[model samples]
Target: MNQTVRPERRVLAQRVTLAHGGGGKAMRDLIEDVFTSVFAPPGMEDQARLMDASLLEPGAELAFTTDSFVVSPMEFPGGDIGTISVCGTVNDLAVGGARPLWLSAAFIIEEGVEITTLRQIAASMQKSALEAGVRIVTGDTKVVGKGSGDGVFVTTAGIGVIPPGRRMLAESVRPGDIALVSGVLGDHGAAILAARGDMDLTSDIRSDCQPLNHLIEAVLTAVPDIRAARDATRGGLASALNEVAYAAGVGIEITEADLPLRQEVRGICEILGLDPLYLANEGTLVLFVPPDQAVSALAAMKSVPAGRGARVIGKAVTAHPGTVIMKTVLGGARIVDMLVGEQLPRIC
Candidate 1:
C-alpha cells in the first residue's frame, strides 16, 4: 500500500540558545519569527531584508544622532530601556533644532532570555515611536551565550531635518544669553538607583524618559533666536553647561534657588551623598536664549507637557570664560566643575 509519506514536523525552539546567534537557519528563523515579526508587520519591508542603508531626501540638512542604553533592571518606573532607546536618540536630534524623522535600532540579546520579554520591549519601542512621530525603518539582532551578556542592550541611531534659519550650537552662545532647564533634575538617576534595590531605599521617583522634539519645536517657534540647546543626559546639567561654556568661550552663572529640584530627588541625593547636578537625566534639556527672549522662551517651554516645570536658571557671562559658577543660597558662589569621573554608571 502506498502510504502517504508524511513530511517531518519542524519544532520551534522555545528559548534562545547559542545556535540562535549562529549565521545559519536557526539564526534566520529567530530573526524572521521573533525580531522581524515583532518590528515589521506582514507585507512590510522587513528589517531582515538588510538593505545597504536608508535613504534621505536630497538637499535637506540633516541632524543625526546615536545612543546606547544599558540601564540595569531593564524595567524601571515610568519607562524602560526600550522607551529610553527611542527617546534618547530623538532628543539628541531635537536639541540640535531638528525634527526627528527616522530611527534604526540594534539589539544585543543574551541567550535564555524569554521571547516574551523581547516582544514587550519591541512593543514599547513602537509606542514610543508613535508618540515621538518617528519611524523605525531598520534594525539588527544578535544573541550571545547566556552568561556572556546581559538580558538585552539596545542601541539606536536617528536622523532628523534641520529647519531653515534655525542654527542652534554651542559656539552660537553669546554673553547675555539666558540658560533654561526643561524640568526637575536628577529624577532619572535617582529612579535608576532606587530601582536597583541595592541600598534598600525606596522612593516615588520615576525616570523622566520622554521625547522632547515637540517641546523643542515649540521653543524654537516662539524664540527663533535660541543660541544653543542640549539634553542633560550623562553628567547632568553641570556637564551640559560646562561643555557649552567652553565651546562658546563664555562663563555661566546660575542661581541655586532658581534650580528646580524635586523634593524626592533632593532627598535621595542628600542621602546618597550625590550631587544632582552631575546625575543623568533622560527627559531634561538645557537651552541658551538671548536675555531679551528668555521670558518668551520660558513661556514657550512651559506650554509643553515635557517642559511644564521649565525655568530660567542662569545666564552666560564674559568673566571666567569656560567655567560654570553657581550662586549659593548662603550668598556665596561655588564653581560647578565638570565631573572628573562617572558618578552613577549605567543609569542611562
Candidate 2:
C-alpha cells in the first residue's frame, strides 16, 4: 500500500493509501468537492458539525443508538449489511419497548468498490426498513482511499418511541421470573461463518436477522408486565441472559434440555468447536417475564411469524442472585457467563 502526499489541502501524507482512501489532498478534495456537492443535504453542510452524532429534536423520548457492521463478506446466506443494519437497530429499539420510527445511515466506502454493489445494498436496506415500518430519514457517506476502507462500513442510528405503559428494561426483572427466547439460536452466527467458506460441516444454517418488532408487540399485548428483553446478537444467548441477571440482580437457572437448538446448527457448532451459546444471532429475542405469565408469553411470542419457535429456556432464581447456571438433562450444573471478549468478532 503506497502512501501519497498532496500539499494543496495542507494535510500530511496518508499511510498505506489507495487513491480513494488517501488522506492527502485527494481525500479532502473528495469530501469537499465531490461528496459534499453530490450527497450533502442542506442541513449537513459540514461533517464536523455532525461530530457529536446528534440531531435537533425536542423531547422526542428518543431511543437513540449506534451500531457498526463489519461482517467479513458484506453479503451472506440470509442477508447483507443492508438488512443487518436495519434489523439490528429495529431490534435494539424493540427490546427497549420502543417503536422504531427513524434511522440515520452513515457509510464509509472504499474507493474502487463497485457501484453496482452499493446500489444493491441500498435497495436491500430500503426494503428492510420499509418492512419494519421505519424510515431512513437521513444519512451520510464518505469514501476512503480504497485500502483504508473495507468494501464498506455502515453505522446506523435509530430513534424510536416507547409505547405508553409498556416499559421494558432490565431493572424490571425479578427473581422467580422466566427467560423466554423467540427461536432457535446460533443460526445467524453459523450463517455468517458458512458464508466465510468455513466448510467445517455441511452448510444448513440461516442468519436469524429478521426484525422482532411484531413479536415484541405481541408479547407486550399478552403480558404488559413483561420485565426485560434483549435481542441475542453479538454475544449469543448466554451473554444476553447474563446481562438480564446482572441488571436485575437475579439468578438465572437454565435447563439444557429446554434450550432450543436446531439440528443443523448443533452439528456445525460441534464440528467448529463453537459453543452455540456464545455464537451471534440476528433474529432471536430473549424476554424476561413473570413466572405466572411465562406460558401465555411464550404462546404470544410463538404466535408471531418471527417467533414460531419461542420457548422458555430458563428461570429466574432466588438463590445465587446475579449468577446464571445451566441444569443439564443428566442432572449436572454449569455456569454461563458474559462473553469476556469476542468469541467471533465482526459477527454483526
Candidate 3:
C-alpha cells in the first residue's frame, strides 16, 4: 500500500514586506495562503453577509464590540496576541448576556516579522473562534515598515445576539447582590511580566486566556437574574469592581481572604510591589448575582473549565455607595480604588 503526501500550504515569503500590503498579487497571495486559508471566511467580499434565525425573534437585540490587542510579546505563555484578540472580543459580548456569532479580525503586520509568526497566530485565532462557536467572517491585513509598528497588532470586532427578556447591566446590581469572580486573578499580567524577562523574574504561571461565553451562558442559565458582569482585562478586577459599583450606585465590600489568587501570581505581585487585584486577567470575569441565586451562580461557574475557581469575593452594600472596600485579614478595612496608573503596560 502507498500513502499520499499533502504538500504543506504556506506563503512563499519568509518575512512580511511592504509589498504584501500593496493591492497586488503579493497581497492576495499572502491573504489567501496565510489568513483566509485558516479562517475559511465565507466569501471574498468587502464585508460579511450575515443572517441568523435568532435575529427575527421579537425583542432580540444585536450586540457589537471591538477591541485591539498589542501585548508586548506577540506570543506569551499559554496565549498569544491572536488568541487574546478573539477571547477578549468574545468576552465583551458574553458578559452582557450576548451569544457571540461572528468576528472580524484585522492585522497590522510590521515588516520583517516572520511569516511563520503570522501563520501561527492566524491558526490560533481560528482555533479559539471554533471553540467559542463563532466565525471569523471577514478581515483586512496591512504591513508597515519594521520601525513604524510593532511585530503585529490585532483588532477584532465581534457581533452577537441577545435573546428576548434578557437584560443585564451594572446598574441592575442591588444592595444585597453578591459579587463573584469566574476564576483566579492576575494570571495574564503575571505571565506576560515573566515572559518579558525584564525584571529577572520567572514563573510557571500561564496566561488565563480563554473565551468566557460558555461560562457566562452556564451562569445565566443557572441564574437568569444576574445583575452585572465585566471581564478583568487591562485594569484588572479592581477596576471592574469599581465600574460596577459606580454604575449600580452601591458599595462593594470584599474580603481579601476570600479573593482567589494563585501562589505564583501573588509572589510576582509581592516582589514587584504590585497589587494582584490591579493586575490584568484575560480569562476572568466579575459578576453580580442576587443573594438568593449566588449558590446556583457559583455552581454554574465552577461547572465550566474557564470558571473552576469561581467564588464569592464580595457583596453590594448601601454604605459608601459607588466605592469598593476590602476587609483586610487583620480586622481592618481599606478602599480598593481603581488602578491609578498603568501598572503593566501592554498587558492584554
Candidate 4:
C-alpha cells in the first residue's frame, strides 16, 4: 500500500521580503504559511480544475469578471483589503444574475509588510468567500520594493454560472420600469474618507461591506424579469444610473426625498461639499423591475439582511432619453451627470 506524506507547515518571517517572491524555498514557505494555509485551495496545482453539475445543464452560461483593489489604508472601520477584494468580485457576478462559484486572488505585496497583515487578509477572504458561497481556488503572489507599491494590492477574478432562461440587460430597461436601491448609499465612501484621517475628520460610520449574492437571489426570486442591475461602486449611484440610461436609451428620474442616506454620511458630505449620490458603496446595488412587480421586488430585498434599508428611489422615463434627472427635496430638478474627476483617490 502507498500513502501520501504531508509536509509540515513552515514558519515564515515576520515581514515580507524580496526573497519571498523569488520562487524559492522562502517563497514556498510564505505561500504555505500565510495564504494557502488560510485559503485551503484544492490541490497544489498551478491552475484550478473545476467541475459542476450546474455547468452541465443545458443553456447554462458562464460568467467571468475581474477587479483590482487598491484602497488606501488597507484596513478600514468595517472591512479591509481582503474583504473588499472578494466582495467586489462576487458582487460583480451577483448583479449580473450569476451564481458565483470560484475566485482567484493575486497579491502584489510591498516589502516589509507584516506577515500578520497578509494572514488577516487571507482570513477575511476565506470568511467572505464562505458567506458568498464561493471558493478561493487558486492565486499568485509577487513582492515588490517597499516604495514601489502600496502595502498590498489585491486583484481578484471570479467565475459563475447563469441559469438558463434568465437574462438581464440594461438595454431592456423600459420607460415604465421602476428603480430601486438595495440600501443606503455613500456609506463605504464616507467610511473610507473618515478612516483616512488626513482631513482631520471623524465619523462613526462603517463601510457597508458585505456579499450581495444572497440579496440578488432574493430579488430575482420575487421578480425574475428584472430588467437591469448594477452595483454602485467606484463612480457611485449617479454614474451607474447614467450608464444604464445611455445603454437603454431611456431617461432616469430619482427623487432626492426617497434616497436612503445615513445622517453621518449626509453630514460628512455637507461639510466637505461633496455629493452623496456620487459617493461609493460596496454592498449597495440598483435594479430595475416592471412597475407592477416593483413592490414585490422591494419586499423581497427587504427580507435580505444586506438590503433591509432598501427603498424605491425612482423610475425610468421616456421624456428625456439618455439622461439622469433628480428631483430635489426643494422641488427643483438637476442633472445627475457622471463624475468629472476623482472625488477621492485610491478609494476601492
All candidates' lDDT scores?
0.87, 0.79, 0.93, 0.94
Sort order, lDDT high to low: 4, 3, 1, 2
lDDT of 1 by residue, 1-348 (tens): 897863433328767788878878777776666655556633334442322222244544777889898989889998888999999999999988888888889889899987677777887888888999987878777898879888999999988888666798999999999999999998999999999999989899999999999999999889988899999999999999999999999999999999999999988889989999998899998999999999999999999999999999999999999999999999999999998887998977
Instruction: Kindly list the per-residue Cα lDDT of model 2 for residues 236-308, writing each as its tens digit.
Output: 9998988988888889999999888988888877877888899899999999898899999989988889999
Candidate no. 2 TM-score: 0.84
Q: TM-scores of all models?
A: 0.91, 0.84, 0.97, 0.99
Assess candidate 1 and give its lDDT.
0.87
**Backbone clashes counted, model 4:** 0
Report lDDT (Cα) of residue 133, candidate 3: 99
The digit string of per-residue lDDT tens for model 3 on 252-317 reads 999999999999888888898999999999999899999999999999999999889999998999
| Candidate 3, pairs of clashing residues | none
Model 2: residues >4 Å from true position, as ranges?
Answer: 1-60
- In model 3, the worst 10-residue window by lDDT is 4-13
Q: Global lDDT for candidate 3?
A: 0.93
Model 4 over residues 83-180: C-alpha lDDT tens digits?
99999999999988899999999999999999899999999999999999999999999999989998999999999999999888899999989999
The TM-score-based order of candidates, best leading, equals 4, 3, 1, 2
Q: What is the C-alpha RMSD of each candidate to the true structure, in Å?
A: 4.9, 7.6, 3.7, 0.8
Off by over 4 Å in 3: 1-10
N/CA/C clash count, model 3? 0
